[model samples]
Target: MIEDPQGTILALFAAFCRVGGCFLVLPGFSSARIAMQVRLFLAVAISMAVLPIMWDTIYPKVSGPTSTYIGIIAIETVIGGVIGLITRYYVLGLQFAGTVLTMMIGFTGPPSQDILEDAAENQLTNLISLTGLTVLFMMDFHHVVMRALVDSYTAMPMGGTFSPQGALISLTDALSQTFTIMLSLASPFILYGLLFNVAVGLVNKLAPQLPIYFISLPFLITGGMFLLYFGISSLLEIFANGFVPVFEGR
Candidate 1:
């Protein structure tokens, strides 16, 4: 093959560092379940797949004196990190919503070691995090993540540096949107828990000697599960819907 070895190696390494660094800390990929070595390989594989397609255009823009090229590479890495962080923070919204739901369901406890991810999470918190990730994969939302990485190069470009103020503003807007979505996603469970607890409290007041609160444990657990089952689909749909705009920052 007629190939420029130096150029190819340079392009490969640059792309690897940029993409790998982003994925190393990005949410789903960064989960405790994925081994660091596998994540590294996946990042390299992604960069390899993308470089051949993008390098023809990207290289020209980045071609310049050594100092200029280095600066461009740094800025591009930062832009990649920004995009990665947006998706990651969106996932955090699910975790935040889970935390709120756990509090409402009376599962408050000292942080315990989680089995699935081997992180410290209350039982309900772990369930929600795992479920959210499962739903993301099932809905092909990760494909959107790859697309966002590609689109970022177009929006931000290879050699150009975005204004720090503008990027900060975008980050702030993304966080706000994530918070709003989290509240909305958990609203059904939130309302249900509130009413259920209030009713239980009233009942307990009326029958102080009857151990009504103890009697309601089974009902509360059943009600919570049913409510979650009914609302889970909608929650996933809402998450899928919100995925794109945050990535595009539109």
Candidate 2:
């Protein structure tokens, strides 16, 4: 049934370069917990599904010289990576905010194995990050990323000249926006930590003989935990709501 098997194969591989490249660094997909084989199969399946929709745009591009085809593959991979990095940076920003939140609340428990990765992380930080990621999955954030990947064909096109400058600018903009959003989310905790520490410092000054620092640790953690219990729902709600505008705006 295939009139041009070679061309079809080339087109599919071309599509795979982009989709697989995106998955290579995508958040949940690229998690260390996910096996490489599973990621590869999922990428291949998605590439196959996407190839037909993009057949007209992609097929013609592959019937070119070997050198040109190789160049296209590289460019497509970078384009896909840039797209993936945008989302990755945003999620990483949330993780950073979690770290800040834990510090502010004085929750300095020993680091434990991360729920999603091999690295050790603060227990509260892990909870916040995992909760935010779970909310993202529940809201189907991957669908948004896939939709952006599809639209990227229109925006970047196949075999077009790669723009490192433009790509860098996009990433920088994503970081900037992510920082602002994450900062706002962690502001209350930052303020709480500062105020709580200041009050504790004054108490220590008043009772120099007392082990105020030791005495205050429990209260600091308890207050922080209480704040988190009351505010976590709001934090995640804002975090999830902000993802769309930041991702699409970039």
Candidate 3:
């Protein structure tokens, strides 16, 4: 048997598709803070690390025509991308919660650059999202996501039939679950904001001369801050603890 360089290259590239595809959109790994070249190198390194374990499954598929090779790469990239998307959905959910928290606390500030992406965001949401993602990293979210990738191979075989319907269903399911989890995490703040706003509205009705919105702003913000100070710990703790399970359960 001849050792073929082309065959070897194809197999490696196919492996890279999955690993790199995931990291391309994976929370911390995909952060704009990290240089693109660095991310590329890191993805290559991780793909190499796992290539040995995945070689038997991947190499067999890439030993084909040039057109077939292109198809294989596309398929692998899509597979990896979907897995990454599901993982990312959870992180994004935290951002949604942060938006809710900001509205509830009435903590409006000038928009700032987001640490994760190239976008303008309020400071409170920015802080919550950054903190939540940081906590997820500390909790080894990469390991879990990677593990899920490995497991995904079993659920979806290498170079087998691709099911758009299945992928769509999975993505929809993830979105639904992520929203539910985020809402649950932000519920307390929602209730607080509702009651506080109602009271402010009542006061405004009683004294039309008073600048109720302005007068209540400090109290609203202060109460919110106090609630967050005491409850933030538990809120984040619960979110971090349940994230993996809730995501994996789906």
Candidate 4:
């Protein structure tokens, strides 16, 4: 049944190198909460599934000499990592936006353990990031990533020379687009904080004897909370909608 067991194993490993590399840094899969063993098994399983689909293209590539095989492994890993990074960067951008939103709203509570990771984070930041990620999962974002992984074989064929310049450009463009989207999402809060602070400053000047700083902080927080309550749905909708275009375009 197996004419070339060695070649088949090599081809499967090659597929693993790419798929596992992507999972290494993928957002939800790479979370500290996920055990390494589980990730490894999942990667292996996906690699096995994908290998047959890509058999024609991948089988021929693995029959080369040892040195060539090693090179292909490295190049495939890098390509997968780059693809994973594009998604990671976009999600991290949402986290960064959450941080900005918290600061603007004066939600400077003590940092707590992050819901997804081990690091500490502000409560509001945690909420926004977690909510956005949940929405992404609900929308089946991983399916998109898988589809992209398959399409990548066409875009960056196996055993091709790795292009550092092209990889750098892709990363830079993802960051640029992510920044613009995050900024726009946080703009309303930024403006609210600015105007609220300016008005508070004037009131303090008018009532120099009073502790305006203390008095205004609660109002600032309340206003921000209300604004977030009203806008969060729309904010996440926009965030989820933008993911596909940014990921595909890059």
Give the distance in Å from residue 46's predicted Cα in candidate 1 to where it truly belongs.
1.3
lDDT for each candidate structure: 0.77, 0.93, 0.85, 0.93
Q: Candidate 1 overall Cα lDDT vs. reference? A: 0.77
**lDDT per residue (tens digit) for residues 193-221 in model 2:** 99999999998899889998889989999
* Candidate 2 CA-lDDT value: 0.93
Q: In order, what is each prediction's RMSD in angstroms? A: 2.7, 0.8, 1.6, 0.8
Query: Candidate 2 regions off by >4 Å?
Result: none
**Candidate 4 residue spans exceeding 4 A from truth:** none
State candidate 2's TM-score.
0.98
Which digits, one per residue and each the tens of the lDDT, describe model 3 over residues 1-250?
5387777777778889988888888988999999999999998888877777877887888877788788878888998888888878988998999888988989987889987899999888888888988898899988998887777777887778778898888888888888888898899999999999999999899999998888999999999989888988887897798778765865
- What TM-score does structure 3 among the candidates reach? 0.95
Model 2, residue 71: displacement in angstroms?
A: 0.3
Displacement of residue 207 (Cα, Å) in model 2 is: 1.5
- Write candidate 4's Cα lDDT for 8-114 as tens digits: 99999999999988998888999999898999999999999999999998999999999999999999999989999999999999999999999988999899999
Q: Give the TM-score of candidate 1.
A: 0.85
Model 1, residue 25: displacement in angstroms? Answer: 2.6
Q: What is the lDDT of residue 23 in candidate 1?
A: 84
lDDT of 4 at 98: 94
